[model samples]
Target: MIVGLLRSLSAKVPSAVPRIALTMKPQVIFVLGGPGAGKGTQCTKIVEHYGYTHLSAGDLLRYERKRPDSEFGQLIDSYIKEGRIVPVEITINLLRKAMEKTMTENENKFRFLIDGFPRNLDNFEGWTRDMDGKADVKFVLFFDCSNEVCIDRCLERGKSSGRTDDNRESLNKRLIETFLQCTRPIIEQYERQGKVRTIDASHSVDEVFNNVKKILDKEG
Candidate 1:
């Protein structure tokens, strides 16, 4: 199904660029955490204050899932609703296209906050293979919030978020191992390389953002 979808997509759009294939060298910061771990909030703050284009992985998948002309719409929707990772090829392709599109539009816009990505080893490995040397990853900004808090926040937001997967039942299935199990290795790998800046995200938004600001200020 994925291959067929990719082929169908390629019939209309340009073929995906292979690894180390592009010339764009944007600055990238990966923002990762469980749902409602204050990642989205901090991303917005970063965009406003630091001028980084916030390219949320979840948002990109959601947008593609909802796009009427998208060949991968149903597949993406089903994967997301099941709390599963979308195919690595599709994700890397979208990320590259977004990077290229934005950079082509504004020559000076190169900084990007890629939020909620590399959810597992496959994601990280695929990114390394398919990002086409488009970016120099600055760091991974990890929001360290407890699972309970993250679930609670998701439930509260579901009241108004109008999202199917934000409710308690979905959050229970989706977020139980999102931080500790799914994304732990990626965080640890970056940690060993001194590329993980973890923030205590159980605090109020302002406090969390302040810590994020300090990290951003000190780091490149």
Candidate 2:
């Protein structure tokens, strides 16, 4: 059923990664928020203060989409422009390689802040199954913000962000269908696990990070 649902949403997943498990148990904190919810801004602060490697799922996807020879470039471009989630296989593969690269580059420095990932329950399921539960998730850091604020911030960012999906139509559909309809359940599931640290993100940069600082200080 999960595979069927995923196929309905995107391309058929390649079966190459039936069970590619992460060998290391890195300290990872999932940084989740809707677009323009300030996840990147706060992730920078967290990295500066905590010496953690910040791996953003959106960033990786964008990088791959622009690569001169990336196999997933066209697929990623289509999905981004249409406000559809990329197949979890491509996303998880990117994240897995990034995480492993960080681990290798820094040896014992394993603290990681994975941003803008597991956007829906399908993504969460894909991560658990593919990663084999090897990564130790410290907690999920969720940013709570209103739709108006998020849209406003995204539109402002779109002025120069150069992202394909930053336009009004794309942002509106993504926020409604993906963020509210899908991502909320991921937050609720993590909340039930007592692993969610919700931060009010409708404030000024410094104001929001001040709250994030408190949560990380306690939860990190």
Candidate 3:
């Protein structure tokens, strides 16, 4: 399904839009965290203050799933409903297209806050191989929070989020299967390279963003 989706989308993409080449490396900072870790909130603040384009992998997939006449709509919906990560290729292709479109529309340098991506080793490896020289990961911002807190936050959010995975059942699968089994390894991988900055997400939104701003300030 993923391969077919990629081919179909590639065929539809206009060849006129230039692809990112080896010499043009965009600035990318990965935002990693479990569900309800406030990644979205912090990313909004970063975008407002740092002039970075915010790209949430989940949001990209969700948008594609809802597109009219989308070939991968059903497939994307199924994976999302099961709390499974979408195939890395599909996500990366969407991201690359988005980045290209954004860059073409604006004159500024491309600095992106890529939220909720490279969720596992497979995703990490796929991104490294596919984007090898087209983009560089400056750092990973990890929002650290206890599972219990995350669960509560997700459940509370589910009351109004309207997101399929915001409920308890899906949140459980996402927290354990995706975050613990998959995402944790990716965070550790970046940590080993000293490219991860852990932020305490149990605090108020303002407090959390304060820490995030400090890190981004230092990065700048």
Candidate models: Cα lDDT each: 0.83, 0.84, 0.87
TM-score of 1: 0.90
For each candidate, give its TM-score against the true structure: 0.90, 0.90, 0.91
Residue 57 lDDT, candidate 3, scale 0-100: 93
Candidate 1: regions farther than 4 A off: 1-14, 17-24
RMSD to truth, every model = 2.7, 3.7, 2.8
* Candidate 3, superposed: residue stretches over 4 Å from native: 1-18, 21-24
TM-score of 3: 0.91
**Which stretches of candidate 2 lie above 4 Å from their native place?**
1-24
Ranking by TM-score: 3, 1, 2
Residues 97-210, candidate 2, lDDT per residue (tens digit)?
Answer: 887777777676688899988899889998887765668788899999999999999999999988878899999988998899998899899999998999999999999999
As for TM-score, the candidate ahead, 1 or 3, is 3
The superposed Cα distance between candidate 3 and the true structure at residue 131, in angstroms, equals 0.2
| Candidate 1 lDDT over residue span 1-220, tens digit each | 8667757655743454433333568889999988889899989989999899989888899999999997789888887788778777778778878888888788778889999888889889988866635578999999998888998899889899899889777676667655567788899999999999999999999999999989888884
Candidate 3, residue 159: lDDT: 87
